[model samples]
Target: MNRLIVTGASSGIGLAIARRFRRDDWSVINISRRPCPEPGVTNIPCDLAQPGAADGLADALSPWLLDRPRLCLVHNASIMQSNRVDTLGSADLRATLELNLVAPNAINRIVIPHLPPGSSILYIGSTLAEKAVPGVAGYVIAKHGLVGMMRATCQDLAGRGIHTCMICPGFTDTEQLRNLIGDNAGTLAAITGLSAFDRLIAPEEIADAVAFAAAAPVLNGALIHANLGQRER
Candidate 1:
C-alpha cells in the first residue's frame, strides 16, 4: 500500500498536502500538535517545537512504517518568528531549530531506514530558504539549513531508490498568512505585489507540486520553487 507520512498537517499548506494525497487513495498519517481536520487521516499528536519529541514517537510510527510499497515522508512543520539578527537570542533560535530542523532529522532517522524502494523524502521550504527577509532571522536560518539537509539526504541515500528534494513556496495564501495580515489591506497588497501574478498562491498549488515531486526521481537534489514568479525590487 502507498502511504504519506507528513508533519504539521493540522492546517495550512500541510493540511492541503495531506488532503491531496488522500484524494489519490494513499493512507495519510499526520504528526502535529493538533489533528488534521480531514476525515480518513491518521493523526499522531506531537509538539515538534519541543526537543526530542520525535524520538519518543518510534513505537507509534512503527506500525505505519512496515512493508509499504511506496512511502512519501514530508517534513513540513515550521515556525517563523519576528526578530532581527541582532535581536535574535540563542534560546529563541534553538527553539526554532528544534522544530524546523532537529525534529525532522529525528523523524528521518526513524522512517528512512524502513522506507521501501520508490519512496521520497520531501522538505517544505520557503522563499526564505534561499533568500533573507527582514524581521524573520530565525526562520531564514533554519530554512537555509533545511536546504542543506535535503541536499545531504540525496547524497547519502544514493542508489537507495529514495529520491529527495526541497520545495520552496512563495507568498502562499493560508490561515497563517491571513492572521499575519489582519485588518491591513496595505500589508496584503504589498505581499501580493511581490508576486508577478499579483496574488497569493493557493495552498493546493503547492500541494500539487509536492505530489509531482514525490513521483519524479529525476528531480532528486533539486530545489524547486513553486512560488509564482516574484518581482525583484
Candidate 2:
C-alpha cells in the first residue's frame, strides 16, 4: 500500500486530507500533538517544535516504510499568532518560527532519506507569503521563509527524483480563522465576500487541491496558489 505521512492531522484541512487518503485506501500516518479522530489513520503524536522531534518521528516511521511502495510527506502543522511587527514579543516570534518553518524543514530533512524514490514532499504554505496583511507579522514571515525552503529543497532533491512543491492557500473557513476573527460574524462575512471568487474556500477544497498535486507527475517544484482568485501576484 501507499504510505503517507501527514502533519497537523488533528483538525481543519489536515483532518479532512487525512480522511480523504484513508478513504482512498492509502496507509496514512498522522503526526500531531493532538489526536485525529479519523479511522484507518495511525496517529503518531509528537510536538514538532521540540528538539529532536524530526529525528524521533523518522525513527518511529522507518519500520513502516519497509513494506510500502511509495512515500508522501506532507507538512501541515502551523500555529498562527496575531501580532503586528510593532507589538510582537520576541518569544512569540521565536515560537512562530519554530513551528511554522524550522520544525517542518527539520522533519522533511530527516524523513527524506527513508523515502522511496519518486517520493513527494508537500508544504502547506499561505497566500500571505506574497501578500501581507495586518496582525500576523510572525506568520507571514514564517510562511515566506517556508516558500524559500520548498524551492531550495526542490532544486536540491530533484536530481534524486524526489518532488517538492508548495501549495499556498488563501484564508479559508477553518478553526484557525475562526479563532483569529472571533465572534465578529459581520467582519468575517465581509472578508469572505471580498474575494474575487465571491466566496471563502473550504477546507475540503484545499484538501482536494493537495490530492491533485500529489497525483500530478508534472508538478515537481510547482508552487500552486489556491486563493479563491484573490491575492494572486
Candidate 3:
C-alpha cells in the first residue's frame, strides 16, 4: 500500500497536502501537535519545536513504515519569526532550527531506511529558502539550511532509488500568511502585488506540485519553485 508520512498536517499547506494524498487513497500519518482535521489521517501528536521530539517517534512510526510498496515522506512543518538578522537571537534561531531543520533530520533517520524503492522524500521550502526578505531571519536561515539538506539527501542517497527534492512556495495563501499580514490591508496588497499573478497562491497549488514531485523521480535533487512568478524590485 502507498503511504504518506507528513509533518505538520494540522493546518495550511500541510493539511492541503494531506488531503490531496488522501483523495488518491494513500494512508496518511501526520506528526504534529494537533490532529489534522481531515478524516482518516492518523495523528502522531508531536511538538516539533521541542528538541529531540523526533527521536522518540521511531517506535510509533514503525508500523506505518514496514512493508509499504511506496512512501512519500514530507518535511513540511516550519515557523516564521519576525526579527531582523541583526536582532535575531540565537535562542530564537535555535528554536526555529529545532523544528525546521533538526527535527526533519531526526525523522529522516527513522523513516529513510525503511522506504521502498519507489519512495520519495520532499521538503516544503519557501521563496526565502533561495532569497531573503526583511524581518523573517530565523525562517530564512532554517529554510536555506533545508535546501542544503535536500541537496545532500540526493547525493548521499544516490543509487538508492529513493528520490528527494525541495518544493519552494511563494507567498501562499495560508493561515500563517494571514497572521503575518494581520489587519494591514496595504501589507496584503503589497504582498499580492509582488506576485506577477497579483494574487496569493492557493495552498492546493503547492500541494499539487508536491504530489507531482512524489511520482517524478526525474526531478530528484531539483529545487522547484511553485510560486507564481514574482516581480523583482
Candidates 2 and 3, the one with greater lDDT: 3
Sequence-dependent TM-score of model 3 = 0.99
CA lDDT, every prediction? Answer: 0.95, 0.83, 0.94
lDDT of 1 by residue, 14-130 (tens): 999999999999999999999999999999999999989999999999999877669999999987778999999999999999999999999999999898889999999999999
Error of 2 at 161 (Å): 1.5
Model 2 lDDT tens row, 144-190: 89989888888888677778788998878889888888999897877
Q: Rank the candidates by TM-score, best first.
A: 3, 1, 2
Candidate 2 vs. truth: CA RMSD? 1.8
For candidate 3, write residues 1-233 as lDDT tens digits: 69999999999999999999999999999999999999999999999999998999999999998776799999999988699899988899899999999999999999988987889999999999999988998999999999999999999999989999999999999999999889999999999999999999999999999999999999999999988999999
Stretches off by above 4 angstroms in model 1 are: none
| lDDT for position 217 in model 3 | 99
Query: What's the lDDT of the predicted structure labeled candidate 1?
Result: 0.95
Regions of model 2 farther than 4 Å from truth: 231-233
Candidate 3: list runs displaced more than 4 Å. Answer: none
